[model samples]
Target: MIAASVGSILRSFVDGVIVLNDRHEIIWHDLSEEISLAAKAGLPISELIPSAGRLDFSRYRAHSTVNGVPKYVNYSTFPIQRDGETIAVFSLSTNESKLKDWLHQTIEIKRQALEKEKNQRNERNGTTFSFPDIKGKSLAIKGLIKEAQAIALHNADVLIVGETGTGKELFAQSMHNHSPRAKSPFVAINCAAIPENLLESTLFGTVKGAFTGATDQIGLFEYAKDGTLFLDEINSMPMTLQSKLMRVLQERLVRRVGSNEVTPVECTVISASNEDPEKLIEEGKMRLDLFYRIAHTSIYIPPLRERKEDIRFFTDYFLAYYSKKFSKYVPPFSEELLEVFLAYPWPGNTRELEHLIENVVIRASETDEAIEVDHLPAYMRRKIFADPGYRAIEQKQKETKKRPLTSIFSASHVHYIQQTLEETGWNISKTAKKLGITRQSLQYHIKKHGLGKRD
Candidate 1:
């Protein structure tokens, strides 16, 4: 009765059960009724469990052909002993589908956790660039960088004005790195790159059901909370969107599209314009009030042409960087190539120069030992030879090389400014007009030459 009751209890489990004699023959079995039973008694255990003969009676997952269809199973074995001596072996098996489901769920959860950690680290770093990466030693560039560094310590908004390819984004990133909120997010977006229809929601975010297929999303401003938000090509933004952005800056709050609820955000807003803000406002492409609100602490980065003294530095820096990147030898720049590079009016600025070097390095053969004029891009070659402006500038630079030392030149320039100031009785406006220059330019020269003192 006790053995029958025990057998009945074991049979109630969903898993399959089998009892085998010492000869590995089936003594009793309780399994799915769909299995064959033509020779149940004394049948070899391997006939039912094909892998059983090789098993070490350990717990493991296996597969078998049930009713001629493959099925998965988890099997465990136990010895049914009699009076402390081994008698028969009992095997228990369950379907393996449940175990597989648990494993998959565990992997998915771990993946999501890792992804969240990575995102958090990225948000904290914000940007990978700094002031050291700007790569120029020209006086103009030095002055600009110094001003940017000083301004970064402040909490006010900034406006960076420069021409295209002047690296406005680089300056913006450096400012973020120096700022108090360096550990927070630094999100940047180009106003002109995105379609106008989607620009508003992209900057200010959207709520669920705001439009067809719209889902709740956080805007760049929210993402940059307690950090910096860099707006590149701000002048390219639609005037309507500019007005909305102006409101956000003034109120320090944002309202999602299709919703009136306001959420506060603390961020240092830095906007950039490739065009002159005054010109953009004059052309009605940008708002005057918006410019004032954002340009509280403005920094103007001079174009590469104005800082031509740094060309050599930038060329060597880019050559070494790209040569290593392309696995090409760092060859010397030919004298003719250097002349061409200087003579050509680089309208695209430093970015153009860097790309040109990358191209030259990629095209250079293993036999080449130096970069010659022929290695230059065709457009650059044409500009160097065909453009009259380029030729004239080159000729003038060559003529200027015959002049006295830089010290004597500065002395003469100072005397000329001082004489002019004396003649005009130190009236800055009249002296500047008589000298055929802008008041600001004359003032700069006066400051440079220390000729601003009264007579």
Candidate 2:
């Protein structure tokens, strides 16, 4: 009676169960009515489990067609022994649909857990990028990087001026990382993204009963303590608030809304704007006194179009980056396409270039030979074919070949190398050192780009 009850309970839980003898033949089975395997004695186990072996089984899943219509099986197996001697095997199967749902749920739960952990880590770090993250190799960029490094040493408030998408925020983060306050909090807020009134409170903190829904809080100035506070799009700040902000910078103290007590502030201020301070001053968008207080040290990040070498460098850089990201093979941009990149004014700067490369990589196929103009999107095609430089290259090939990787010094190899040679008085060793290449390699590039006058 107990053995019968055990068998009935097993049938209730599992979809099917089979007993195979030591010879691996199915001797008996209590199959579910939903699974029409046609139970029989002495059928070879391999007939049902084609991959059957004597190894321990897992929750194996596979499709079967012997039941007239195709169906999936969730299978598990183990040796069933008698008195320490192997006699038969027990094969258990559950509903495949139920098992698959369970696996998906398990995977999703793990993914969410990992995502939460990553967010916590990022929050503690305060910022995600540094000086090395800004990829560029042009005189403009190199000189700016050196200047910014020098500025990072001091505690004076700084203003970074550049066109939109020139990575103003990246420079802000890098400066914070290189400064003496590297370990401290790095707080950043976009002045333009929030309302004028809210931005004031957000920067200066709030005090309870100051306004409806206001509460006591530590503002960015107090919270940043011995760290860095980045205010992006500072030009968008209101004229009235600019004076209040100037006083805070001068006094190095912050008074929360509706609070009579003043709190001393210790964080370094790094402000950025898409427009020049001088221009904003002329437009009455910024106060004159505020300018000198904030612009003690000004850093100008050159646009991508102004430094064509950086453009070429980032093209290859981002191409390699996205190729690894998506695990797809995409050849570098065609020479004509590259020339187009150099000539076209990238208003959006490096960010735009990185995004374009990612888009191209996603659309790349195994059959694509290289990244030709045809590979570019429809809107980009209209812009490229219209450019005179691109059309000239289309007419016939050009002599300006791209230098090897690490050719940052020679943006356009022939012209820039000639200029560098003249500037360095044709000193091969010094030029090579400056360009981060060996003297022998520099000589090869000099020959390849046909700067034979120096040789």
Candidate 3:
């Protein structure tokens, strides 16, 4: 009778507990009701635990649910040691909502402190990095920066569209740096880098022995939980993976390969694509449904050629960066060199400019102070003399004496209009609406400028 009474007391004290064997399997669970509910809700319990062989007990924390509602729980685990060898692990979990709340508050405070520390470090190191590093004196660039800043505070998916080498990644990083998830991991994966066969497993993960050589592995999506996932070159993502990706975006859940169990992940998705995704959809290379699902909010970064006015700024910035990096004391660009740089059309954009500057900084003689036109790459010198278009444009502007519209219109109006049209897949009505222009005006501009027309 005393033993029966002791058993009853022990059962009453046990609120909710999940016991895992060395291989992180749910061997026993005291909260059967909650587990059933979770299963019914499509959340698999298998993902919540690790395999016995791969168990890292220190990484596991007990969480609690009060009256079956998920309140925070705190659990501690210790290896079951036998003869100085760990045979298994024993864990104890209890209601820890109040403690979790306190810790969360403390963490936030520490996060602010860390941000301050980072800012101080940057300042001390004389780093001029930020959204401002996106060099542009144009109003459009400024507006873009402002809009991106405002959008960063929200937890919305952002789609960045731009030509290759137009700083899409930089913009994505800036958004993450200024976001609520700034303290969390910022994971970036190139959709085009992974093979089509492995893309699904790379993004969503796989279970133990799901395939040959498939040890239990967590995907980029799971690693980025409670953080940000920057999907670069999203247009290159395989069509088969698009459907699965859409499911993940819509359901906020992921199921490992060969496992029906779903793991819930809370992550912000930021995607970038250089190609015209709408066209890709039309061409059947991309799925329209996936496009709409991912493009919640969109921003386009203009190419460097369009933003000629910013060239000098970027050049000076790159020159300074490379000078310090290469431990060279090269002086600023001379008037001739600056003029040549301004005249040259940068096909490879900012990336090319950065490389050119680095080369010059590293190779410049100690006696040579200022960077001159002669120090420039051979191709740049040849291009300047070979192409008469640069001189023709300068002559036309000089004769017209009109504020050079190319500098302003090229960077902001023309590129923005082209991007909007491409996003709408040349649907004039939608493109016009996006551009805040009348359909007739859009048509007139399209014809007058011969935009998107083949030579």
Candidate 4:
């Protein structure tokens, strides 16, 4: 009698209410007539709501199609406890299908708003970098590029992992340009740079009268529709915002702030982080579930230091690049200066190298034929000269002037061969050309020395 009375009251109060045992098997329900009783019979709650299995979140939205009709539902699950132990779960669900029309209207309104903004901003729908723009021939970089190119045709979310100055944005842009959506906008946002209070609305969008100061707005997700949205420094995003981001990624829908209506989002997301994502998860700075969702296709860019063979190539490229920009003569680095560059550890990676060369080019005299140590900044000069590796190079150069070439070759032949291979991106022909030997001779040396991929 009591159970019947409670069911009667719940049916009048809620659109539907269901009870489940600890194992999530439905024990009882007061479902609406429109819902499918056949579908709910003797099934786990997860069958109705995917996220209901863990029961981790406080609320969840679920959509189902029944008899050619769509049903949108808002679900709230509560634990029923006795003697301080949860024995069953009670879930209250409300049909939100009525809001479907509202969702569509909201999307159309935002689209019109965004179209106006795009015209005012004069935004272009393309990127600056293609595969060729990624300046590296090292095996690590070449492998990374190959993976990126292969996946660009797909629409999966991409996660780029690397240390700062590893050119994560360059990879993101290249992937966007190579994809089928190349003609669409390539929107990039720095999650760490934006203020947290405004970050949510900026990405997902906002409706008029959503807040006192808020006006109708289209977010980055909408702006990048039919294209790519690059989220840089993702680890720096607040944990609260990360939850909403995960939902958008999973459902491909975004609900503006202060609005219950959800709009469809079709843009591909490419997120990046300079820090190790695992460490960030352990530190509570990033959510593990979000990481898993966004990292469906992962790319890790090796640091410049790890690929030291590319240093000289990048140096020369940057020199020529900045020389043309400044309209100055492209001066070569003195032997002593080049030795210092090779020996010194570049902590700032390619960006640092580029900036340093630009400074050197600007400081060069019209009569200068080569850049010497004096041309470098004071800090770099101090760091390079203080390095013990530079001291060793100086001693080696002095000894090279006195000893026979064969003696030097006998000492560092394998090491020289390995460095050349890496610099040429393991291309046998290029390595041979750089070493002034035939490709067959290079292959024989590689096998002879058992040199493989470098660390």
User: How far is 58's C-alpha from truth in model 3 (Å)?
Assistant: 59
Q: List the residue pairs that clash in candidate 1.
A: none
Off by over 4 Å in 4: 1-126, 386-388, 391-455
Q: Clash pairs of candidate 2?
A: none
Best of the two (1, 3) by lDDT: 1
Please give, for residues 1-455, the per-residue lDDT of candidate 4 as tens digits. Answer: 99899988886756787778877777988775324442655444466644443354445343555676666666677777789778888777766676676898999999999887776444666566778989886888998999999999999999999888889999999998888988888999999899998999999889989988998898999889889999999999999999999999999998888788888999999999999999999999999999999999999998887886688678777877888998887557765676688777777778888889988989888576567899998988888889998889878877877785654345487788888888888998999899886454566566556789877
Give the Cα lDDT of each candidate. Answer: 0.78, 0.79, 0.73, 0.81
Tally clashing residue pairs in candidate 3.
8
Better model by TM-score: candidate 1 vs candidate 2? 2
Largest lDDT belongs to which candidate? 4
lDDT (tens digit, per residue) of candidate 1 on 1-455: 88678778876774567778767877877764322332344344565554443334545443444466554566667776678766677777666655566888999999999988877767676686789988787999988888999999999999999888889999999899998888888899998899998988988899999999899998888878799999999989999888999999999999999888999979999999989898888899999999999999999988787776777778878888887887777566754466566666678899898888888888777675567778878877776679676577567656667764453235776787788889988898998798775464566566545565663
Choose the strongest candidate by TM-score: 2
Q: How large an RMSD does model 2 have?
A: 12.1
Please give, for residues 1-455, the per-residue lDDT of candidate 2 as tens digits: 77568679897888887777888776877774324443343334565654344445555544444446544676777776678877877777776755576888999999999988778646664888889987798989988988999999999899999999999999999998888888888999999999988988988999999999999988888888889999999999999889999999999999998899999989999999999788888989899999999999999988899998898789878888888989887755655567778887887888888888888999877565457678888887887778776677655442334424344434565577777778888899988787775464567567545675554
What is the lDDT for 147 in model 3?
90
Q: Candidates 1 and 4: which is better by lDDT?
A: 4
Superposed on all Cα atoms, model 1 deviates from the true structure by an RMSD in Å of 21.8
lDDT of 3 by residue, 1-455 (tens): 77556445545754355666655556655553433444456655553433333334434333334466575444445556668766665444454555667898999999999999888754432222358667777666788899999988999999999888778888887888788877677788999998987888888898888888887889988988788898999999888889999999999999988888999978899999998888888899888888888888889877776776677778777877777887777766654466566767777778878888888887788676466767877877677667675576557656545655554245467777777888888899999898775464576567545689323
Residue 275 error for model 4, in Å?
A: 1.0
lDDT of 3 at 419: 78
